[model samples]
Target chain A: MNPAPSSSATDAAPVLQAAGLRKSFLSGEGSIEVLRGVDLSVMAGESVSVRGESGCGKSTLLNLLSGLDTPDAGTLTWAGHPPRGDRRAAFLGMVFQSFYLIPELNALDNVLMAARMLKPPGAAERARAADLLARVGLAPRATHLSTQLSGGERQRVAVARALMNSPQLLLADEPTGNLDERTGDAVIELLLELCRETRTALVLVTHNAVHAGKTSRHLSLHNGVFQ
Target chain B: MPWYLYLALKQLFPAGRKFPFFTAISVLGVALGVMVLVVSTSVMGGFGREIRRWTVDTTGDVQVRADGGINRPADFLAQLTKVPGVVAATPFAEGVVMLEHNLKPSYPAVRGIDVERVEAVTPLSKYIYFGKLDDLDDDSVILSSQLAAAIGARVGDKVEVYSPLLIEALKSDEAYLGRELRVCGIFEIGHQALDSSLVFVTLRTMQDLYGRRGSADGFDVKITPGLDPDEAAARINAALPPALHGHARSWMEINHDLIFILQLEQNMIFFLLTFIIIVAAFSVTSSLLISVVRKTREIGLLGALGGQPRQVAACFCFQGLVIGMAGTVTGLALGATVLTFRDNIVAAFTRLTQSEAAIERFYQFKQLPAHYSASYITAIIVCTITVCTLAGLLPAWRAARLKPVEALRSE
Candidate 1:
């Protein structure tokens, strides 16, 4: 079940929520129904995992939650209100299975890119980005090109990039999928560590159940519903 | 602002990335268009300046004559001078008589002028290339260089000058009727049409030969620039008594054919070569469109990443402008260089053809002495930049209306 904030916790709403989220894809053959009805919630400083098999709607759910794609039939909300469109995606940080780091940019540049894309929060954005990169233990390697980094190194940078703007919620889909077992564990630890530091809510998708156990809660996506 | 154009330009220089061949071709097309603009426009501009010089300096800005041939009015000169903006009015006593040297046959043209007044109006005085304007003594006449050479006359040589401005010569004698004229000077004037055609002498000489006294056969007027030739002519016409009408001619009314042909040629060249610029702009269009297609995912990412569609549009539009501006600037440079060396270019072509006969047959002028006018250059540059901006449209449109998820997902 989705968790709610404790009374002792500050009177803050869940950082992210999705109610009756449904998405479907259409082809010439007919249509494919991926997410029939899904609901999700994560409070601040909480980490939740969605462990699922392939062809499920885990990624599509993330797409809708992040406002990168529209939902076919449900409401998606961030903070308290429904995210109207792409601009709301700013409050949510998204990382993917492939890292999807722009290859031409250096690690630091990629991280700073997101912060810069946000309408100016004033002059301190650059300082904040550098400080954030340092917290992720990527400060020394900040200027390194994406191609020069190992697979595990790239994911750290991507994670650091996602956390650049001190986002309210961070969603990662198999961020460590391409990494070795050791690298995957290290990247997960770094993600959880950063989440605690920022008091940000986290939702991670993974195939590794053992990894899911490390989160505060975990769920299985079975038959278009989360359990 | 989208951060995408910066990304695109950065990617352009990425390691292992080969140059986009289309960019090179676009630059070349721009250069070619600019080259055509410089060369053809310069030639046309040169021709216009020459025409203005031909009209203003050679034929006089305005020419006035009387309606009837035989009636020479005594008060006409004073009346013309009284007209506002009449800079100077001069009388000419002209009629037909046979001109000949010891060798060739005699020919006749409208003949005499007040030497000083003629100089004030016509470029003939300035055209005395080898001799002096002061050389037209009372007994002396000036023949054009071509005519002088044809008759073999030089300073101190005597030849017969004859005017056939009237039909009296035909009426009087079937035999050669003429008087002596000492050749005082010869002129080339660079006006080939007039060189072999006109002969000039004092008005007193024409009055004696044409049997006209008091007022000469007709008079010519030089008008001030501020004066409308027609308006001045109207004033002179109104001032005159009903017996005579002041018929003053503006330049186009006189050399209508030459000017009409030149203007038509200049306009034809301009309209024809405008297509070249249009094609160049089309190159910008295609280049920008291709750039948009190549960077579709980038645009989508920018849109997804918080860029307004307007910023995305600016990115592609900036790319188009960059390509266009860079190309136009480079083209202007290359065009100017080509114009600077156009003569060598033509000479090289002549040498490549290897035919003295063909060289003699083809070129209008030996070297293309381009009249460098700033207005023409400005026009070419402005028009090309405008065309380049228009060429940016399709790509900018695509950039503005892009859907993020669909674009990135397709990639």
Candidate 2:
């Protein structure tokens, strides 16, 4: 794996910071810990990857970071303040392994979902959604439903949706886990190029070592702690 | 254009022809419930109105009676006719009397009315099926067809009538003073109670028999067209002489029990039919619960994208509202159509079943009746929507309470 980029003087302050994070799950008769005393910080425009074996809590850590799940004992702050209420969606975006696109909506509508969470989409938002679909090379398929799209196209549409609101931090959990090698590589390349163009920070969780090598920083999880 | 509304519409009528079957059934259930309620209430209201109209037409809209009797009916009739809505007023006397025909005795209610003014006060003249109302005289009586049948008397037959006063006189003197009257006509008003109990004669005959000269029991008043009987009665009461201790009452007051029973029956039917809608509303709850389960992951995705729990709940509620609206509109249309063609439908059914006597024996009417009111329709719509919305609450609460983590973790 490529080594993380050297610390630079011009880098901005961290957009996401989590410290002493701990999480547990109840399995049958006993409680099992998923994350333990984990600390992480991601700067603006920085790309980071977390790699681990299955059930090693990489997805758990990503969920906690994305605010989709809360830690048992930890403080997570977005831009130095606790992400309370709907402020998290304003600042952060997430991509899942399953794409999680609403089946009822078309690809363009799925892309517009983030922007429309708090309010109705205007003409400008609609135009931007169309542009994002074009950028993802699926403009012709914008009107197609999730069931009609191929796996790679669905993931690409999901990527476009995650960027709809131009969030400062993007957390992706095994986004390419359901794709073939060629389609996975292509999706990853497209995602990285868009993140770089927008100067958005990325925290990706993956099992692919080759994919992890493409990020600026690489980390591994063992025993519920990142090293 | 709210996001939740958009989500609700998308979920309810999903693309690719994936219509929610359970939701459609729920809507249909509400529609049928509303349709039945409307049709039932309308028919009941029509029946009540018809009965009231018949009562007023037969007995006059308002009746003015004195404490003992109107000792001088001319002044009373003149004053009553001068009232604002009084169209016509006539003096009438009534009593229970025993009539003997061929030595078979039958008690019937005897009424005395002025031959000329009776036509103006009541529609009795129009219901005359034999002879003429003008033929009534001191010695001639108009017998209701039912009373005539019971006494085995016919037109031109001599019937012996004994008044209560005559019976009292016979008890003291051991001699009966009775009137041998001829049946001048037979009338049938299509009301069993009135037809079986009423006999009409001239005002002089009742006065002479009861020993009340130059007086009558009361005055029957017909109000102006379209005037409410209660209002006319009120006006008459306000104008009455308190010394006479006279009272005026509308036909409705005379038959309050029957009217009350009709209204109560209608309300009971409405209440009972509403339960059908409530049961239908439960279907909405069940369908929404299923939707919540099927869309758990999508719900989590929405939450992660910043949809609040309240918004999630509102989404399901909106879906319920849509279903209610659809059902209510369709049901109103269906109900109106059914009511409009009620007579035809009933006739068709009767013909198909070949049960002609069933309709006549049960309803006593050739055609079914229905009355539609705007207020009633509005109430039904409001009631149905409220029920549907209430039914949506439980599932909506369950959906809102779902944890994003647990939901996303589900397949």
Candidate 3:
């Protein structure tokens, strides 16, 4: 379902590295281990796609990589350092299947929120947010509330928000799951194009095999391990 | 601004929205509680103030009295006026008399006042409603408004006064005739107790009727403005000789029981009305809890976007603070407006209910009174803001405890 990265890409150090990562959940009297010592590495400017069926620990892996959840036993690093709460905002960004745009804020404000989390947004941050919105082709609808937007438009806004802080790595968990096939294809294309143009790394979790094929590297997960 | 506070404000007063139902309702609840506290406390304070004013107006700032009638009042008066804070002093005599006009008889307390010095001490002329204080002489008397009505007497009417000495003279087997005096004026003091049962006569007339010459029961002392009555009374007590056995008491010390009851009532009202603000705080807590539950997914997204748990908690906490501040401001404005138009509002309501006369009969006030003290207003602000800020804690804790992974999974 995928191809290996080019020789030039592997020459650089990986932006995200995870090894021996494990996680579990309580199931009745006993516990069930969801992730068992998983290991992965991705280089700079690489778009890596992970495809899996439901409940295959794909989201759990994404959570651990983003530092939203702790791995029971593993070492995970972003740019060769352990994830810290204060450093998380400047190191990475995330996009969700639900798009998760705050309903109270407009499209432009939702994008600027990422930068605001890092620091108070100033003129440069505002310009970047506008440029990102224009890149996603939602510039004209920047002032519209998330509720007033359609599914495809909301995902585009989410993509713009994910890149607002110019983070090195973006973790997207089934971002296009809520949109139709044609819209999903367009979002995936725009996402890859933006990542490549900015030289930012991406880890996309998705169910569509065709969308997975478009990335620089693709992997399938089954029985809690990548194959 | 911090992102958390900025987002908090945006959540409460969202951009491009016409109506914010949650914020409006929450603010209104807190505002109403604050308004009631302000209005009720001010009205209670007003009643207390009015009582003090009339008490001092009727009795002067201080009254000096002896065990027996003071002998040679002229000497005591000279000493009384020489006190450091004493501005002036006037000698007075008091006794009960049987007053009869056109065969309608009433027993009323009568005060004998020195016309020239009484004005300097008690402002008695200000309360005169009919005729003039200058018209009162040894052959004339003044009646309280209600006492005049009871005897069906008016200015220029002749009334017979039977002093207590009449009974004493009769017991001694001596003939005594009641004095006939012309009514010269009627006064209304606006105090139910004082206005209903009192008459005034010249000091010389009272001395002759009581068979005491050149002597008076007590002297009313007026002190310098802004001087403490109790302090001035202490000064006056030190000025008189021990042989006179004279004791000076401030108006507050004389009306101690009434003042105590008024203070107790105001404190009880303040204690009871504070519960209203507590109830409003509970409403705020409930609303914020609901908001936290509803926004679980968005909160998870924030965590995914690198927001710390503490910052997320701050978002909800700031919302409560904003609501508290807005409600306090609005409530103060509303309370001030209502207090300004209190007389008109009372008039309209009394007219609508046809209870104008009933209010005067029961409350003894023709117009509603309101007073706002700095201390009481400060207490209200501090308590309301503190409770509202504390109300946000539970919801903030609940939000902070949520794990981003679990919250995202929640349906």
Candidate 4:
């Protein structure tokens, strides 16, 4: 009983923890509640999948946890830093549904752009960006504009750009939704390989029960809470 | 990399298929704005100075006189020299006179000057086309080429001088008795103000009309270089004896109307030509807006990477600034080229005309004046930059305040 009193006694490493979280979206009529006093714990170096129906607010919960959006009432912290420009960008990396690569920049330039954001005056930042681009197997296309890359390559660049600052948390919102199953598996494997090597906490928001089996922690979002 | 300006610009103008069009418009706006400003500015600058010189060379900087009389004392000329900015005080007499040739007479303004003192004040002696400055001492007169040709008189040809100054005879006062005099000199200034209406003679000639008194109506004084005419006049005015009220004025004041017109033209040209710059700025803004709209995904990505709202705004603003700067540089180059060859260009246009003489008379300038002052150049540059930065505001704000979620959602 005395040892169970400490919060660290739980299996979770407390990469991110929320207590009695609440969120409501204002519709034309009034407000539609999205989450109702939910509590959850996610550990460091654990990959979790959230599955729910279309209107069950799985993305909303992931956004809240990643600090992309704020909950109406909740206390959440990640890597000991709250959501802010530098730390948030450094702590969490999100793969949006529609690969948001800067179109004007080349693949390496895109990755370099995010790296530049991390430490502006850092010397040899370009070489580091080049290394990151090469690691993503885009060495030849480093100077090719994002528009030149195929959907898969574009997504790969987006993934590489996410890791530009070496993020501590990785969030994938239907990372495979836009690709064929074969290509999707390749991306999923890439995400898994990168996250495992970096020891990053991972969260996947998806409706595919198949993806749920790929993670150690799986939960169903129902009503306004997760169980 | 992280500065709001660099990031925003980097995001807004990604290399794409549309890059060529954007760059071209930027160059065009700059070149057009520069060309128009250069031509207009240089022309107006020349017009004003020619008018100024036309007046400066005619009348000495300051004209001093006894307030209530037609003549000043003999010692006045010597006393006038002590005044500051009085390089030389030369005595002169002027009166209306008639010149008769072949029984046909024409009237003109006549001035008599000392042969030596006038040398320092005017270049009349150097320009005598048909006669010499030394001949001013002869009983022979110097008739302007225009008046001489009209009267059918030439150097060594005799003409009668009928003075307006009257002599009192036993019965009543009468105009001076006519003198049959030889024409000794003829000068051609081509300045209509000088050529058509003026006649010069030796100071002794004007004295003879006044019964050989050898006195003058007033003295014309010249100022040293770098001296402000108005200030010199003020100093001379204070230096004068109370008996003589000196009228002091600048060369600009004497030709106020012509000067005013030149200034007005300069202003109108400046204002009208600035629209070119404005149009360029508009093009810059438009191009950047297109870039921002096209790069919506890129903007969204930057936002996702922890780009602050300010960074988005800065990027858009920076793109606009870049366009503006490009236009400014292009304009400067364009303006400089036009200004550099302004003369040859105008001469070419004038060559297409039927008569070079007619162009000369109409424009009153031998070569187009493209006088450039540092202030003028600075003004054009500042104005261009202002409009350029202002043009960027709307797109920059749009970029800055973009909602990351919404922007990412844009296709």
TM-score of chain A of each: 0.90, 0.95, 0.96, 0.88
On residues B1-411, what C-alpha lDDT tens digit does candidate 3 reach at each position? 888998999989999889899999988888888888898889888887878777777678999999888988888888887889999988899888898999999898889999999988887889998999999999999999988998899999999999889889999999988999999999998876677788999999989878888789999889999999999999888887999888999998998887788788878877888898889888988999999999999888888787889998999888888888777788888889899999899899999999987887787777777889788888888888888888888888888888988888889
Higher-lDDT candidate among 1 and 4? 4
The candidate that wins on lDDT is: 3
Best by TM-score: 3
TM-score preference between candidates 1 and 4, better one:
4
Per-prediction interface RMSD? 3.6, 1.4, 0.9, 2.5
**Candidate 2 Cα deviation (angstroms), residue B317:** 2.0
Residue A1 error for model 1, in Å?
A: 6.7
For residues B1-411, what per-residue lDDT tens digits would candidate 2 score against the true structure? 888899898888876666677667888988998899899889988878777767777668999999889988888888888899999988888888889899888888988998888889788888889989988989999998878998899999999999888767867987776799999999987666677788998999998877788788888889988998899999999999899889999999988898899889988998899998899888888889998999999888888888889999999988888888888987888888999999888888999999866675577545676787667788889999998988888888988998887788898
Ordering by TM-score: 3, 2, 4, 1
Candidate 2 Cα misplacement greater than 4 A, ranges: A1-6, B16-20, B67-71, B82-87, B93-215, B223-235, B238-245, B349-366, B373-375
Give every collision pair in model 4: A104-B14, B8-B315, B9-B315, B313-B400
TM-score of each: 0.82, 0.84, 0.95, 0.83
Docking category for candidate 3?
A: medium
lDDT of 4 at B26: 71
TM-score of chain B of 3: 0.92
> Mind giving the per-residue lDDT tens digits that candidate 4 earns over B34-90?
668866876788677666665566567766655453355456766768777789767
What's the lDDT for candidate 2?
Answer: 0.86
The number of the candidate with the highest DockQ is 3
Write out the backbone clash pairs for model 3. Answer: none
DockQ of 2: 0.56
Q: Label model 4 with its docking quality class.
A: acceptable
Q: Per-residue CA lDDT of candidate 4, range A52-163, in tens?
A: 7887887777777766578899777785556666576767788876787766578877787676676673657678777767776788999999889888887888788777
